[model samples]
Target: MVGSSVEGLTFDENCQVLSVTAPAGASGLPVMVWFHGGAYVTGSGESTKYDASLLALEGVVVVSVSYRLGIFGYLRDNLGLLDQLVALRWVRDNIAAFGGDPSNVTAFGQSAGADSVYALMLVSDEPLFHRAILQSAPLGARGPERAEMTAALREFVSVDASTSVDDVLAVQKDALSMASARFSPSGGMPFGPVLGEIDLAPAASRIELLVGHTADDASPYVPDQPEAWEIATELVFAGPARQLAADWTTAGGQAATFDFRWRPANAPLGACHCMELPFLFDPAGWSHAGMLAGQEPDPVLAKTVRSLWTGFARNGMAALPSRSLELGE
Candidate 1:
């Protein structure tokens, strides 16, 4: 898909693994690095769900990352976060080759990816990127206890510090789904960054942030339990995001909040989780709009969101949603 969208494509073999999409003749464009969401057990930077072609063409360099996941990412240590931090360092050092400004970069993610953004922001002592756009971050995830992971691991293999990566992957590939389901009550995700290990440097710092949630973001996750859905969405995604905005603002940082309430026509998923993606990536594109039929997203509305996202990376300020959402104080 990316083959036809840009003038070039490149992958790195260093501490990071990212795909760079460079627009034709684009140079010094602001960079937008994307992180994909998959419950933290599944997903890669290469998922079609996160295509950055249109966004890149609109005047920014796009970098989509593939970070560690599942047990490989968060089991006993924050190895997954280590990979993500390395990716950021790579962008800070190498995005210029793709016409991206090393100093002007924005990191964006949704769901588990959004959770990653939150963790990353909290851990960085200095600016790895100038801005962040978090979508539906599950801040309510409980820290996985090492004993629990060890017990889970023993259910698959006996360990003596002699276990190999192959043994670990073999067990995780088969057991993660079960483990995540078992630990669902602790954290919303199958695996997440552990507490005491996800501390951000200096405890407080201002970062230009654009955070939001779909009005009905939790429907897809808990369609049957309406009451549970509403409460979880607020406590885990919406409420925490609002508090983060308020905290950032209180710390003298700038933040713009949004409520994606655009309902899709003829779709059971109202303005559900990830529903805003079709609009942000490409409202008119067939991949995401196949079901929109007569309910195609407004071109003006799509443009407005695209502009706000890129604008945040470019200028440290995100414009309000077309329906007029306000930036929090």
Candidate 2:
């Protein structure tokens, strides 16, 4: 919403928004649409953490999208995923005006955002984008069933259309507490795209896929429990990603996979969840994020990773190594 807009285009007041960044004097460039990750409770495309200017400088048109979060996005329905679908339709129609080739678009995300991208692919009837990049997607942390969510919500205060946003958020927090207590063992989110509500089938066409996870993605969450860290990482991030990539290939689709093992020097978390983000985007955008451990991404490595991403977007043929990728300290 902070970038150029098409005349007569308007978004509803529920905050379904997107921001665009295109290189100067560029035309017919590949487009990358991003969805942010925050366990389905936080994050937005407008946040400084997602600035796309550096990505656009790589000669692609970058669009960062924001959809509803928390109860508004998931409790009543999977509105967040629908909101992403709408954003994709918008890009399909208007991205050409921003010097993007609508036919050559990639949908990418991290964590919950990556899960949303996978959900979008399952529900979309048309090929809205040509490729997908799912980074650290918690494919194992699927949302709970509608009945379970309803039961959880019953433990909190009820709300009506007239309820204040603050009041609704307060109730939502309580509901999440209840839901997490009931579902955390299975890696379920309190509010996100729900399961067993709709029959999910693969998209009409096999999308080119690049799916991967960090080597020590769960270290931050269970730092004191090394065994728990390993189990959680495999159950929630790495294992599912590997299976998905394998299935995609078995289904005769082009797929690439990577395991990021580069940890910041002296960082306690190792190559934890979201560690790859700094390499994909501008390091400055993520400077204040404690996860990066006060270190900037290696410029040489960042360039290499971004180039690999761009190469995949251009032709869907970048065969990233299946082994762990490490950076020198």
Candidate 3:
């Protein structure tokens, strides 16, 4: 619970509200709202790992938001996404009270959270935020067909369409496990935004984007199976991100892309999934890098990563020094 004290000040009773971290004596600064990752099955904006206080201290009002998860979040027309939208609305309407500039907002997220950021890019109406950082979004994961999605929910959860709302939540843990096994057609986890076309409503809120994936983000899951790993990575993270970059740039938008190739010494992992997290959060005062190779975070790498992200938020572009961004100019 790194920023537990700061988070407790803003979260709502249901824990669905946004947790904010503001620098002391700040005024009219940029805002950076964050989303957490958990495959849409689990995760909370309240999670300590997401505490962006260090980033907040850089003079921006850093906000980490909580949303509905798993069956509760995705089954009902993607309630979790709606939850995020509501949070964004809240930020748009009230962040100024917290000393944040509503018009200069940067919404960023990782993994499932990153999926939400990417989806938000397509939001056509008066957008809540102006810029976005989509880190490791699995755009290739299509939404399940209505029939396929609900059948598993109905059978495994032991509830029919008319089942009492109370009964839907009574599903057992074992049932969840069973559903996961069947739901994931791809090698990775199955849960994300539903697939559908949303013609954007014209507006001034075209989202400026910065996107990337860790070099070996998907290796752990399918190491032994080369073909599986390649397919999963392409369909889940890498390929779609690149395509989105191309599409956005083609549409005359500034969309910067990168490949996080920082290799940690503790484990054999090579810039694997979630490895870029510590740097983003600037886990200051935290000496150990946890599972990221059991080594102290390299001060050089940590400083560069933070500078890059914060710089992006401040400039609405990937404007960082050469050392700050690995894929340098």
Candidate 4:
């Protein structure tokens, strides 16, 4: 693993490591910092799902950051988001050693990670990165209801700080089950950056942006509930993504948007939540992902996506998806 794999429940010195990959002989290149998503509870920046080597080959430097998650991260505060802030500051001060341009950093992520980037935009007092690329962020994840947080807290109150990490995870799993059962169409995650709990700083209205969602981003999660899928796809992803771009532009910031409509041929899931990831990362890294269905992403589409992403990091603008689909028949 490029960074320390936090795969198992046990913690080690390498748990919160950050990994960097730079092009051969790279210097003064644009840098991209990636935050992986597992609903704020289940991912590691070191996961193979986020291998950035292929993206680095597109003539840029890529850094993947690992942050705290779940009860350890958001049980009482925005600790995960704070951890990311620390990583950004580290990049600002030290990325040059990796042949990257510290001033041209772009903070990018998918799903919950994308939400973290958005939260950072509001809370960061100083500009940590020059640009941001938010992929499928649940911008519509409404929150801070006293009742919901209180209910969530009750689950944690029984957990002792001295409990083993693995035991704590079991408790988290139980809590997640309860939370999932209580989830409604009105978008809000059980564990994520809560609005009222986080003090809102100045808006990062000036940062350039590249934002969008898969055409059918909510399909996979609501495979059995079509109505829920429709509502979640639009309310939780598509509608808010478009609104974020519009608001960015309205705030006098440069922004680019895309609608990824490509899914594997005959993929029942359609272009769901993470459909575009293989195109941005190395398909090999996502080989075991159920969403891909053992299919290889079109290499041409992958190249196009990589180009668009790196182009944005280098110059803050990349051509939007020209057609409804970037791949598939």
Query: Residue 236 in candidate 1 has what lDDT?
Result: 62
Estimate TM-scores for all models. Answer: 0.80, 0.88, 0.82, 0.88
Candidate 1: pairs in clash: 122-200, 123-200, 142-187
Question: What is the Å distance of residue 52 in model 1 from its true position?
Answer: 1.0
Clashes of each: 3, 0, 2, 0
In model 1, the runs with Cα more than 4 Å from the true position are 1-16, 142-187, 197-206, 283-295, 318-329
Residue lDDT tens for model 2, 213-257:
888887776788867877889988888888887777776676777
Against the true structure, candidate 2 reaches a TM-score of 0.88
Rank by TM-score, highest first: 2, 4, 3, 1
Model 3 agreement with the true structure over 1-329: per-residue lDDT tens digits: 11222233342326586788999887789999999887776667776677688788767898898887665666557677778888888999999999998988998999888988866666435568888888888666554443475556645555556765455556634556665576553314444556466543332137777877877777666666645655666667788788777677766676777777776564554566777787777554333444465555566776777677777788866464431234311
The stretch of ten residues in a row with the least summed lDDT in candidate 1 is 1-10
Q: How many backbone clashes does candidate 1 have?
A: 3
Better of 1 and 3 by TM-score: 3
160 in model 2: Cα distance from truth in Å? 2.0
lDDT of each: 0.69, 0.76, 0.69, 0.76
